[model samples]
Target: MFSYCTDPAALDGLAWFSCYLTTGKHMSIYYAVGTVLLLLAITAPLSLAFGFGGATAARSQILPLRWFGNTYIAIVRGVPDIAFFLFFVIALDQAFEYLRHRIKCPDWEAEVWQGNDFIVCAAAKLPLGNAPQWVHETYGFSLAVLTFAIVFGAFAANVLFGAMRAVPRGQIETAEAYGMTSRQTFWRVIVPQMWVYALPGLSNLWMVLIKATPLLFLLGVEDIVYWARELGGTKTPQFTDYPHGDWRMWYFLALLVFYLGFTKISEVVLDRIMARLTHGQAAAAGEAQRKAAA
Candidate 1:
């Protein structure tokens, strides 16, 4: 990044360190930080939307919809996260390719499953075989995002379902007494009240989601953890410019700091949200706030 970065061998002290930190690989580490944040930004709301749908479905009067919602929450929550992450990505990828293969290659002679290998026609390849590097990266990142949303959504659904149930039965009855339909009671009374109950669980889920960002490496997204390990490993002058000893401890330390700082910020934000949601309500938190104000 600097004119003097050209000759790393002669530089020493701060000069050498500056050059080392400005390398192409180091820039990638910086970019990976953004990648981690982007994953969280995209995944959080998508997961919440999924959770809302699942929770609503679980509460539906329709037997089949309720069964589906209950089964989805049960299966996802029961499975270990790592196991789900690994299994679901492959299954989803194959499902996509298989659909495309059937649609695009209807007349093709080759069986998709030949022995142990799963093959698809060239045209049906995700991002296509000859696509640019960015397209391939985008495809992988999209898959990672979807995987995260599905897994986290199930947990969120559980939290929301309990929250929905916690809304006072008296409130629902009062709404009905006022001639409100069930849908109107749910939308007007229950939905507003549920947030005060849901905030704590959702807050915890947010922290868990933040911590899970490292799993992006497993999904081939080149997230911060991946870059940290790659850049922190022992390097020799023989292999590349700007050689350094094993610095993984320091790199990982930075990651540790980043996560803690992010988590702290989230806690602050969630606390304020909780405060807002609880304001003017009859819940313990709201009562406490009222008492303190008085």
Candidate 2:
């Protein structure tokens, strides 16, 4: 912040705006942007991994494993995301504390569920009662990331399951005829060919995931939307310096620009990835690429 910021009232025009934008709270808004990006970066791959596992399990020859995978995908996909986020976070948090309580306070005799409230021993408090602010924030963030992964993973699993099936049966037969075991056939022929079919659905899922970042606000994470609404509200001089009228429209406009720009960049990247995956394959996309190259 500039030295002129010391007397915000005396400042005007660009000087006033510069100091206003550099305030501690404003810096928090900047950090919130990074928070959103970080959430996406961590959640995307985690969700994909979960999806891959679910899809693999769903396709397993073992009846119980297949049932488990199918049930997971069906239940998660059927539930509304907002309902899942709200319920799952509380349930998961309590589940963790319950396990810890059993281990750390086995001698304690108080009931965990008392009509309305869920309580655990002080020793079992996540991050402890005296942990630093950042630890609490990190714990909440981790929960949000897990919740996002689980929910999106279900959808991704469905996409991948269908993609896996779409791989030509003849390819698997050919691989097996070449002395490949079932595992070898899947790894060599099925896995490589499935991506071209999966990419379209996965790309749409990526876009949905990006849009869903705002739900972090509901999860108690101070994301960009939270900061935007807080900072954009009408700020009277009675409350603080550099007061401004309602500016939420401007704040949200910036968010719109950010999301649009980010998704546009994602589209370009996904297209390139799709091109790479399709290269030299037998799919229609591969045929088109070959024609274009020729």
Candidate 3:
């Protein structure tokens, strides 16, 4: 980033540090921050959509639909998240390849699981065997995002389901009395009122989702943690221009500050949202707002 950074070995003090931080590997660390932010932006809404659908389905009039939704929530939430992450990514990846194998290589007569190996045709490989590096990285990241969405979506579903139930029965009854159908009552009456109740739980879930971004390493993505360990490790003179002792502590300290700042900002935003949602509702929060305004 600096003209003075041309020779890292000759530099000293702040100049040396400046050149060190400007290295290509360190640039990747900055990009990793953006990656984390991108994952959060995409995953939040996707998880919410999944949760909403799961919560609505759990309350469906049809028995089978309700059973399916309930089972989804129960099973996913019941299992440890790490276990689910490890299992689901492999399963979903194989399942995708299996479908592709059926479509691309119908004539092939090989079993997919042949004694500890998942054998699929070359055409069936996701991104193909000769695909570019970016394709492979994107495929892995996509799988990680889906795993996060599914696991957290289950928790969000449980929060939303309870929130839906917490809406006063009288409100729903009044909608029914006003000639609203079940669907209409749900959308117009129940949905609007449930947000205030759900906000706290959802806020907590959002924090959890933020914290869970580090787990991306487990999914084979070269995330911030991977970069920190790589760049901060002891680098001998033979390896590169920049040589440093174990700096993992400093790297981790920076990460800690990053998360703390992110969560604090989130706290401010969610508090404002909660206050806005509380206006004119029957909940105690809404009542407090009304009294304060008076």
- Highest lDDT scorer: 2
Report the lDDT of model 2 for residue 170: 88
Please give the range of 10 consecutive residues that has the lowest summed lDDT in model 3: 1-10
Q: What C-alpha lDDT, on a 0 to 100 scale, does residue 244 get in candidate 1?
A: 86
In model 1, where is the ten-residue run with the lowest total lDDT? 214-223
Per-prediction CA RMSD (Å): 0.9, 0.8, 0.9
lDDT of 1 by residue, 139-216 (tens): 999999999999999999999999999998998999999999989998999888898898899999999999999898
Candidates in order have lDDT scores of 0.93, 0.95, 0.93
Tell me the TM-score of model 2. 0.98
lDDT of 3 at 18: 85
The all-Cα superposition gives candidate 2 an RMSD in Å to the true structure of 0.8
Q: Which residue pairs show backbone clashes in model 2?
A: none
Report lDDT (Cα) of residue 26, candidate 2. 95
Candidate 3: which pairs clash? none
lDDT of 2 by residue, 113-188 (tens): 9999999999998979999999999999999999999999999999999999999998888888889998898888
Q: Summing lDDT over every window of 10 consecutive residues in candidate 2, give the lowest-scoring window.
A: 169-178
lDDT of 3 by residue, 1-294 (tens): 899888787889999998899888899999999989999999999999999999999999999999988999999999998888888898999999999999999999968899989999999999787999999989998998899999999999999999999999999999999999998999999999999999999999999999999889888888898898988899999998899899998998999999999999999999999999997877899999989989
